[model samples]
Structures are given as C-alpha cells and as structure tokens.
Target: MSEGKVANSNRAEQREQLSVAATATDGVQVLNPAGEIDHHTGDALRHALDVALTAHPRVVVDLGGVTFMDSSGINVLIAAHHALTQAGGWLRLAAPTDTVMRTLQIVGVDAVIDCHDTLRQALAD
Candidate 1:
C-alpha cells in the first residue's frame, strides 16, 4: 500500500509540468519555460527567474512553448520585472503564443515590458 501511494505521488508530481532552462548570452540572461504555468508551476518559474537575476539584470523570457498561463504566472513576471528594473536592468519577453499573449495583453504586461516577436529581436534589443 505504501509503495502504491509513493507511485501515485510521483505521478501527481509529474502532472505539474513547467520546466525552465536558464542561460546567458553576452550580458543578458535568457529563460525558456515550456509547459503550463499555473499556481502549481508558478514557483518553479519564479525560482528560475530569481536565479537568473543573480547572474545578470537583463533577462529575456521565451514564452513560445508556454501553452497556458494564469494570474500566478503573471504575478511572478511582474515581480521579476520590478526586481530587474530596480536593479537597473530589464525583462523582455519573446515569442509568446496566442493564449499566453492574450493573458499578458489583458494584464497590460506587454505595455510595461517589451514584448518581441522573436528571440533574436529580443536579444538584439
């Protein structure tokens, strides 16, 4: 019974599918997150951003692979953007999908943070 419970727990953990790949190019930090971003997965994204911030101030978040997002993810991005700006850096967003772009638009994140159509554009700008 305990083994069955452990397996079920592992499966449940797997259901929270949000992964972040952090890297740096030139002087900017880039974070690529793939999967749904809800309350369950928001912390992972937040932690990744925080880690990236430690390396450099400017960050470009690649949202092309994100299929869905909720208020939690938005809040995280807002916090990261605020932190970056306060640190004399900025956060740019790259390649957000239609669903995620709609959410960002509704929240006016696009206005506050620069949103580019491509990663290359974001990196350049």
Candidate 2:
C-alpha cells in the first residue's frame, strides 16, 4: 500500500500545501508527509497514521520529506505511538531532516519515539 495524496484542511481561505500519505511494505508502515505539519495540516497526518496503524503493527514514519513540523505534528506522532503501544505495536521515526530532528530533540519527543538515521535501520529494530 504505497500511495500519495494532498489534503486540504478547514482553513477555507488558505489552501494547505501539506501532504500526508502512507506506504506499507514488508510488514513496515511508512508515512511520508511533506511541507509543514502545523495546526492546519496535523489532521491530515493523524488520519494517515490511523490508516497505517490499522494495516501494520510496526510503523516507521519517514520524515525525510517533511520541511517543517510544529507541536500539532508532534501531538499526532505521540498519539500514534500511544495507540500502537496499547496494541502491543510500536512506532519509529526515520530519516528526519535536520530541522525536524532538531525540533524533536528540543521537544524531547526523541526520548519517547526512537529516531533512526535510515528507514532500514528503523525496520531492522
């Protein structure tokens, strides 16, 4: 299940440039979101994660394509992590861009969700 789609939030006048999509291969689910994941676009990410979780237990979110992320994005990830944890599953973030990685570190999100330098490394774990 590898597909892509652009989502528009309720911010009527302002169209969203953010895109959130997912792909599942070899028992690992990967979510790829581009552009900013702020209040307007966080819902898109949450929905994508929900779908991905339903299909795979071990989920790896590939953040290499993301340009920016705010607390809303972090909240989505945390929620996904909690859901997966409750289901005896897990979530990991892989290939985050420098900015995204720095944000995760500063917010202590990395402490909860493991961050890998590569998708392969995350899948291996």
Candidate 3:
C-alpha cells in the first residue's frame, strides 16, 4: 500500500479508539468533545471534524465540555477550517471554556475560526 494509504488507515484506527461524538441538525454538524484535547486526543477531534464535514457544509464544534487543549488541538481546528473553507463551507467554534478559549486566542486560532459564546449562536449562523 502507498504511504498515504497506510497513514490514513492508521488514522482511522486511531479515530476508532477515541470517543468523540458528532451530531447533525439542519445542515449543521455539532461536534462534542469530552476530556482533554492534547496530542493524544487531537486525532479524535480531527476524525470527528472530518466526519462532520462529510455530512454538512456548516460545522459547529461545541467545546463547552473540553477541559484542556494543546497545539495539536489547534492544528486540527485550523486544518478543518481550511478544508471546510475550500469546500465552500465554514467551521464555527462554540461554547469553549475559558481556558480553551484562552488557548485558542493565544495561538490566534480565534481569528481564523469564527467563535461564538454559545452553541445556539453558532448554529444560528
């Protein structure tokens, strides 16, 4: 198999190991992540985001339940944002806890991904 295929297979396996859940409503997908989102959990978020993108043009990530996030998490969001934008869609961040919000702001991710104070607002937009 090609290197890219192998890597994708590995990613699929990894995504299966994580417990992220995604829901869709009115053409918008909402991804709810639990626990911490560091290097180990970032792939799960990526998979969830990828799945969301497949189902909807507008994706909203609900971060109200996330406790922590690292650079890996930020990278996943950035990549997802670019992918969605290129596909004529958009990614929205919703209800991020203070710490996660701060981390996103520190990395300047908030500027690239539209963030809202609540999921309702994100879904509405």
Candidate 4:
C-alpha cells in the first residue's frame, strides 16, 4: 500500500482503539467498550450510549473489553441510566471487569443500577 494509505489506516485503527463500538441484537443494544474510559474517553462512551438509546429502549453495556475506568466513566453510566429510566427504559451493565465492578460497588452505584453477568441475562428481564 502507499505510504499515505498506510498512515490513514493506522489513524483509523487508533480511533477505533479509543472508543467502544455498539450493535443491536435481539432488541438489546450491546455496547462493547474498549480502552480506558477516563475523562478523555468518557464522552465517547456517553455518545455511544446516546446512539444506542435511540435505537433500543433496552441497552446493555458490555464492559468486557474495558481495561480501565475512572470517575468520569462512572458518571457516564449513571447519567445514561438516569436518562434511560426517565424514558421508561432500562440501561444495564454486563460482564464488568473486576476493576469496573469494584468501582461501581464502592460508589454504591451497584445497588442503584442493574448489573448482570451476561447480555443474555440482562436482556432476559
């Protein structure tokens, strides 16, 4: 490939690495977020939620690929959860990594939100 083409491809890959990608499956929107969801990437995660909410009332954020999460990440989830609830829908977390799960528990968010072991379980109810 040409040098410019290779550079463009690399840039695209980097962009993909920075944010989560979501898809709809069986009336549930499954968001597979990646990378670190700190202040910089939190907006991306929120945007993903916004987009997902538009299509499906029920949204499941599959955090299996998330390597790190901070307060901003927690805030994003909380806000989305509230928004979904206000709309008479539900936003749930699925397969959160140990770190993410611990953070939620520590912040008392675990009790406030619904979390499941898998997307299938999240969607079942």
Model 3, C-alpha of 2: deviation from truth (Å): 46
C-alpha lDDT values of all predictions: 0.94, 0.86, 0.88, 0.85
Candidate 3 — which residues are off by over 4 angstroms?
Answer: 1-18
Return the candidate ranking by lDDT, descending: 1, 3, 2, 4
Best by TM-score: 1
- List, residue by residue over 1-125, the lDDT tens digit for candidate 1: 99999999987776678999988999999999998899999999999999988899999999998989999999999999999999999999999999999999999999999999999999997
Better of 2 and 3 by TM-score: 2
- Clashing residue pair totals per candidate (backbone < 3 A): 0, 0, 0, 0
| Candidate closer to the true structure by lDDT (higher is better), 1 or 4 | 1
Per-residue lDDT value at 106 in model 3: 95
Model 2: lDDT equals 0.86
Q: lDDT tens string, model 2, 16-54?
A: 567877778788888888778889888888988899888
What is candidate 1's TM-score against the reference?
A: 0.88
Instruction: Give the CA lDDT, 0 to 100, for residue 71 in model 2.
Output: 95
Predicted candidate 3 versus true structure: per-residue lDDT over 9-115, tens digit per residue: 98766543436778888888889897778787788899888888888978999999888888988999999999999999999999999999999999999998999
From the highest TM-score down, the ranking of the candidates is: 1, 2, 3, 4
